[model samples]
Every structure is written in C-alpha cells, then in structure tokens.
Target: MTITEPVPTGPATTLPGALSLRAEKQPDETAYVYLRDGEEPDGSLTYRQLEADARSRAAALAAAGLGGGSAVLLYPSGLEFVRALLGCMYARVAGAPVQVPRRATGLARLRRIAEDAGTTTVLTTAEVKHDLEERFGDHPDLAGLTLVDTGALPRAEWTGGFPEPEDIALLQYTSGSTGDPKGVMVTHANFLANVAETEELWPVGPDGVVVSWLPLFHDMGMLFGVLMPLSSGMPAYLMAPDAFVRSPGRWLAAIDRFRGTHAAAPSFAYELCVKAQEEGKVAPGLDLSSWRVAANGAEPVRWRAIRSFAETFAAAGFRPEASCPGYGLAENTLKATGSRLGEEPPVLWVDSVALRADRVELSAPGEGAQPLVGSGVPVLDSVVRIVEPASRTVLAEREVGEIWVSGPCVAAGYHGRPQESEETFRATIAGQEEAGRFLRTGDLGFVHDGELFVTGRLKDVIIRQGRNFYPQDIELSAETSAPGLHPNAAAAFSVDDGERERLVVVVEADGRALRTTPLDELEARIRTAVHEGQRLDVDEVVVVRRGFLPRTTSGKVQRRACRARYLNGELKAAAAAERSAR
Candidate 1:
C-alpha cells in the first residue's frame, strides 16, 4: 500500500455539489471504465460526459414531471445504470437502484421496494425494458408504473439547478432473504458524508485508481465503487459480479493492468482470488503492489483466510498491510469503521470460554486461544458502541453486545416505515448520560484495543445454558473437521426447544463426498467437532449437496432460511437424522 497523508474531510457534502466541483476542476478527466471480459473497457465515462449524461436524463425526468419524486432505476451492470442513477440525483428525485425482475428471480423484492418508496415510475435501459415487458407485462405490481428508458431519451438541454444537500439521493433496499425488505432513505448529504469518511481513512486521491466487481445495487459496491471515484476525482474500473465469478483472476488482472489503487469486496471474494491463484488459474507475474487499499467488508472477516491471502499473494508484490477488514451496513449509507491507512490489520487472541460469558479474555498464542480479526475503529466523525440488547445498556470495552452506531452518515429513517424506523433507527441506550439516538445494527461484537470484532448476528446467536455461542465459529469447526466440506458452504443455527437452545449444523459437500462417505460417519464427525469447539451439544447434523444451502445475494449463508427448510423437511434427502437430540 502506498503510504500517504490522511485525506482532508469532505468539502462537498452532496452528490450534486460534488458533481459541480468535479466538473469545474477536471471536466475532461476519465471518471469510470466499464469492463466486460477483456483488458480494454467496454465503455468509458469522463467527468464531463458523466455530468452531461446525467443532465440529459435529469432534464427528461423534469420534463416528465418527476421532479422531487421517487423513481426506481433498474439496469444491468454497465455505464447506463450509472447515468440513470446520477440523472435521478440531478433531477432531485430519489432513485431506487434495484435488480430487474426476470423469470421471477427478484420480482417480489422489486415490487416491495417500489411500493415502499411510493414510486410508480420504473427507470431502466431499453434492453432491460424489453425483457421486463416480455416477462412482466401483465404483472399487477408493475402495471400502472411509467417505464422510462433513460438511455433512449434524446439529449435534453438541461438548464435547471441541481439537487440540494438535504434532497433525497437514493433509496437502498435491504436484502430481504431473511424477511421483508425495507427501503433505507439516504440523503445526498448522508452519502457524501460516508464518502468523506472513507476517503479520510483510506486516503485515495485523483492519482488513485479504483476497481470493483461488486454489484452496484448493493451499498458497498454502488457508493464506494460507482460514486466514490466521482467524489474523490479518481479514475475507476467497474465490472459485474458475474464477470468476476466467471473468472476471479480477471479482477486481479484488472488491478495489475490498470494500476488499481483501491478495491473492496467481501471476504468470500478474497478467498476466491486466493484460490484462483493457488490453482494456477490466474496468469503469472500479476503485480499487486499498486493495489493500495484492498478492503474486505460486507460479510464476516476471517483472520486465518485473510492472513493466508496476504502471505500467498506476497510473492506477487501484494503487501500484507494492504488488506483491510471493515464493517458497515445500509443504514449508515456506507463505511463506518475500517482499517487505518498504513497499518497491518489487527487480530486478537482471546479465550473462547470467556467469549461465551459476555467477556473478553486475552489469551496467549496457545491454550485454547481463538483468533479474531479486528474491524478498525470509526472513521472521520462516526461513533460506535456495544450495548446490551434487552436493557439497552452500553457495554464496557471487551464486553460482547449489540452494536449501535450514530452519526451524520446515518440515514433519517427507512422509507415509509415509521414504526420500524422508530424502533431500529431511533434507539436509545439506557443508563448513559449522553446516549441520545442510535441505529441498532443487530450485530454482536466487542471493542478490544479500540477496534471492533463483530462476533455474529443477534438473532443467530445460539444460547445454551445461558451462554452465547456464535454459529459461525461452530460452522467453521464443522467445515474444517471433515475433508469433504466446502468453505462458506455451511450454516449453523440453534433449534429452540423451550428449555434450552440445541445446536443444528448444516453443511455442503460435493456429489463425490455424498456418494463416497457414509452419511452416519460424516454426521458424527461434524457433531463431535462442534461439540469440542463450542462446548455445546450438537442436536442435529445435515450434509447436503453443494449449492443446496440458501444464501443471500451478497453471499451470506441464510441461517433462518435454512432453519425453515429444516423444519419443513425440505432438506431431508440431503441428510436426515432419525432421532432428535435434546
């Protein structure tokens, strides 16, 4: 990573305000490059071109009487989606960037976002509009909406003022795989505030190059990947998530080819990249020294896997300190806490027994030590606290509890959800003199040495004999206990038995393993391993074929969904136990 001075805090706190600044400073500079498969970009957008495209679409929306209203913008991964979203901001309209419904994949979520946002207008590209018309022409949810192709609209001579700092910029919809989706109403100021914080910590400037393959509909990818380059005056390279999945090496190759200075993805992606290089799938001699900010966030941070990645890629000029493990959610607009600019990612060795007792115990290298990677402290002006869920009392340092965040980056509230918003976004910590309002993140973690170590989700924590056990730890034990299981292809949860919580483990193995290994023996290994690791009795163990486990769009294992499938006997064919253990 390139060591540099910390970036100054945000001068432009709004997208429109930032756009005007970029246009005035370096209008002809390249802003973004959209790549598909090869080295060269499929399409490119410059500062002037980006501003003009957004202006044309904004003028079209204004002419259509959509000013100061909400609109759903759906488009495939490309530069056109960029134009549509920014155009909404320029038009002073709240744009909801959602995945287009096709063959009933994500249609229901789209409907909910549209209804929740109170928007009837659907903004998409010409090609996607044809697909929606063919697949959802008679659909009731989209029947009354005006479908506009921002790409096809003739260039309008836009002459109106831009959006205000307090104007609505975008509506970020939560992935509702576990439950119903909610639209997070993000203002322009909120989005830019986060960008400023990210810049201050990561320290990227006009000389930097940003690369991303994360989906644009998600917050991590959209705000940091698509919009941050515009605000920071850095050139960016964009690719679809599928593009990277098809060939993980393409992501690293893009970095080497374009001299990428900043990039962010979930931990799973880093695993994929490391695996690709290990398997000789990536071409040799790819230099990653230019990769300054290799951020890992939007999912669980693994200490061993990331350290292994840094060590493995070090032969290719990858620095160990470049990998950053951070934490954030949709409510904060984007980044909240992340790694420092020039420090190695921190990891804590703690006692596992004490972890279950709501305590943080520092342990030496051996003697039942569990290593956890640190999610660095708050950036810029955001504040974080660990609070007891039931009493809402703030927890002391090294005490595990629910995470609460409060800052200007926090959104006003969820769109059209007064009650839910008040409950979640307007939470107050009990017994604190200046508790004030905070956003309950529903995540369980602790502060050690002033850094965050997120343990697990509050709903997914397994309680056995009044002690808390994180399912991810148990799932890791299950995956590593056997040779057949795949990493991240496991989900662990607890079955509520009224008296106490019993552990239930579900893992994925290839067809070869399912056919070769005896199911009884496999289940016993998983049971014994989880029991030994978490000190909890395993009630059930199920091994399904790979791809059977349900996952969120961002690649998180859906424990609640897996529990539903287990209760309904949908996963019986994979691995079924005759007796239930209590």
Candidate 2:
C-alpha cells in the first residue's frame, strides 16, 4: 500500500473521469484482487496492467468495427466484467452491465437493452454462451450482432491509451423496481464527481483494501468495489455473492485475512450477520479493528440492524463509530450523502402523532416518539432541500417534504427517456432563478439539525383515513416484537379496500423455531405491536416459510414483486398452501 498525494486544489477535469487518470498515473499499483474460483490462487492486476487490458480490449473492439455508441453488457460482477466496462470507457462506447436473470438467462434482456441503445455488440463469458445461442441465436433483431467471450478468445494486447473525462463511460441500468429497466447515462464527469465526493466524505488512503461481495451490475457495487479503489490506487478483495450468502461468516473472515480497512453494504446484510451470530453459525474471534469505513447504504438504513450487529460484533473489535449511514440513487451517480468515518450514528426523534398527521415535526428523543436515523448532510458541492412535492416550495429545516438534490454530482438525466428525464430533473425550486433546481427524489423526509432523515418513498407510503403510514415502520415493529419471525424477514404493503388502503404485513416465520412458540399467540403479538408501534390497523398477518421472500441479486427486497405475487394469488400462507394439497 503506497500513498499517492492528493491532486492540489485547482480547476478539475470533468471528463474521462478519475479512473483513467489513476490508471495512467499509478500504473504499477495493485488495482484489484479477484478471489480465484474453486480455491485457486487469487488473481490481481496493477493499475497499469488493468489500464493496458482495458485499452487493448477497446482497440480490439474498434478493430472489430465496434466502437463509439456500441453497447456491451457484462455478466454481473468479476474482473472481466469490470475490464470490459473500462474498455467501453476507453473506446467511448456506452456500456450496460446487467443483472443476469436466474429464470431466463441469455441475451433476451441484452438484445432489448442494446436495441434501445442502438448497440450491435455484446460482451459476456463462455458460461452463458449456450444460453445466448438458445435464446437469441436465431432472433432477427440480433442479426449481425457481435458476441465477444473473453473466456474463449485470448486476451487482446494493447499499445497504449486513455480517455477524456467528458466521454460517456457507462450506461447504468435503473428502475430495478417496475417496468423495463431504463439506462442512466453516466459520463466521465459524473463518475469523477462521485469518486471525489466519496473520497472527500470518507477519505481512504492507498493503504486501504476494499472487500466487497456486492453484485457489480448495480451502480453502487460497481463504483464502490471497482472504480473507487482503482481511482485511489488501492487493492480490492472480491468474492462471488453466492459465497457470501452461503456463509456470511466468510465475509468477516475475508476482512480479517486481508486486513481490509473499508467495506459497504445494505441494512439487510447487517441483519443477516446478526442472525448468523445468534444462530451460532458465524465463528467468533474475528478481528475487525482494521475496518475504518463501514458504509450502510443502497436502501433505507434500519437503526436496529446497525445497533444489533454492532453489539454482537463489538467483542470482535468492530467499532460503532465506524458505522456510516448514507443515501444515494442511480440518478446521482453512485453516492450522495454519507456520515464521516469515526462519527457517532446521527438520529432525529420526532412527534409520532405529528409525523403521521402533519408530515413534518422534529423533537428530542423521549419527548417525541420514534428516533429515526439521519442520512447526514450533503457532501461538498451538493445541496439537499426538503420542498413541497407539488409547488416546489423550499421549506425550512424540519419541514417534511419530498427530498430534492442539486449539485455537480447530480447526473445529466435518465438515458433515452426524455419525458421521464424532464419530469425528474427539470423541477424548479423557490429561491435563485438558476440555482437550487432540486431533483425530486419521490422520497419523503425532513432536515433536522442540518441532517437529512429519510422516512420512505412517497409512492410506497400508504394513506388510510387521511393519515400517512410507511411500510418500514410496521415491518420493523413486527421484526422486533414477533417471537418466531426471522430477523429482517418481513415486508409491509397496502391493499385498497374500496374506500381506503389497508395494512398487510407478511412475516417470514422460522418453522423450526415456531414449534416452541404458539402460532396464535405470535400472530396476536405481532398485530398488537404493529397497532401500538405504528398506529395502523392490521388487515392481515401472513406468516410464510423462511427464504420465501424474493430479493434482487443485489440483496434488495423486491417489494413490488412481492406485492405483485400477493395480488396475483401466487403468494400464500405456509400452512394454508401446504394444507390445500392435503
């Protein structure tokens, strides 16, 4: 680990981004370390070597007549996936790294996304060659499309190269919730802003090692795991998501083995590790003192999850101050706001009754109701405002409204969708005529003590008898109060009952643990908790088997998918679905 002095304050180059410059400037430093498959020796690349590979591949694609504007999709995460994406950057091509669907793997999604991007080239590994051949080998739309597999072809050689900071580096796929995923155009300017912002807020030196198992398809995973480390000339320890899922203890072990200093994950991961500890599944005695930045993001942060995990791992030398809460979306590149390293978790308690009735009220803990975790102030060069969702009135701090972001890090817009882009990015704010044009986040939150506290998405909120309710509030209550409920294994949604919406919570029950506790009593207690904790009338409490809740490859709960299945009559209670056949 070598320390590269920071570039002095001056006019910054917005194009071709930081990664390309770091590759050229620190070519000999280790850029990445891929944990070899099947227990082989780990594979690594220096900054120079990785850049050379990217340049060679870009030149190769150009020689093959696939250059600018050509779209290529990588298979989730790996050294190959990242190198190919960088190659796209080097060639000035728009790259889309997609999540390979487990049900129907192939160029099915690729062909559609490429067609949208006007792309004729696709990059992938040999493992999915047969699927691609079977799915789109004969499709008329894929005619003349070039499919390059690095697994089969020898590595292309390069002479030398670099890209400008203004070039389009990657086309990030967004809307993992509903409709066909749309591409978010990210330029070198966009990429550099995210890197600088993250570095400024949570500075990591060249001596740092980033250990990640996040799927690289998503922007956060790709930026944090690959680009962030590479730009800083730090080494990254990578592993397959399956390995982490099978044994989360391996993640902690990997950190201990590599003496990793920085890591990031969603709240569910923290909950999962806590469960592993409670079940005696994870081995004890792993040292986590080397960790400095433990970022919790990609979804809403649950304070309980953080507290529980910190308590369980405190004896292992994990510091609570290292825990960082952040907020970001694909539209703002990868990062937006994060608590600085070695800072206490920030929380804002508010009047529970006022929060539900009026939507904006902040107070001290015990004086009010629930204590919510704050998302922290915006990073340097970014400005966040809570404004009226309809009129765009910039409200004072502590006034709850739609969260809006305006800054250099804010992305240009959604790719290929002018209508959606106009609606999301073109909103006018009260104040300066040209400045404070906030990006409507569709998220409801308030600013308290100069810190942002996100409650829930505006679209995801349930309205009942003129009072507002967030699903997370009810879900968290059930997890805390239910006896047999699996940790962090519950979802709350709303169903219309003609006049108003009704609350429905589905808890993933631990079947083995349920035998000792009465099901009737457990259900009653959960219902009571929800009613008392959140003041919502429970319509139904469906307890299903563990591992039944569907999640994205990146470990985010597919709430829309769950709601779709629930409405389509596919999801059912474990006992009822079993008894029906008998």
Candidate 2: tens digits of C-alpha lDDT, residues 129-153: 5566676667764576677785454
User: Per-residue lDDT of 124-207 in model 1, one digit per residue for the tens?
Assistant: 888888888888889876677778888888778677775667787988888745357788889988988888888888988556
Clashing pairs in 1: none
State the C-alpha lDDT per candidate.
0.82, 0.73
Q: How does candidate 2 fare on TM-score?
A: 0.89
- State candidate 1's TM-score: 0.92
Each prediction's RMSD over C-alphas, in Å, is 5.1, 4.2
Scanning candidate 2 in windows of ten residues, the lowest lDDT window is 1-10
**Which candidate gets the maximum TM-score versus the true structure?**
1
Q: Which candidate leads in lDDT?
A: 1
Off by over 4 Å in 1: 1-10, 102-105, 136-146, 176-178, 431-435, 497-500, 515-522, 573-582
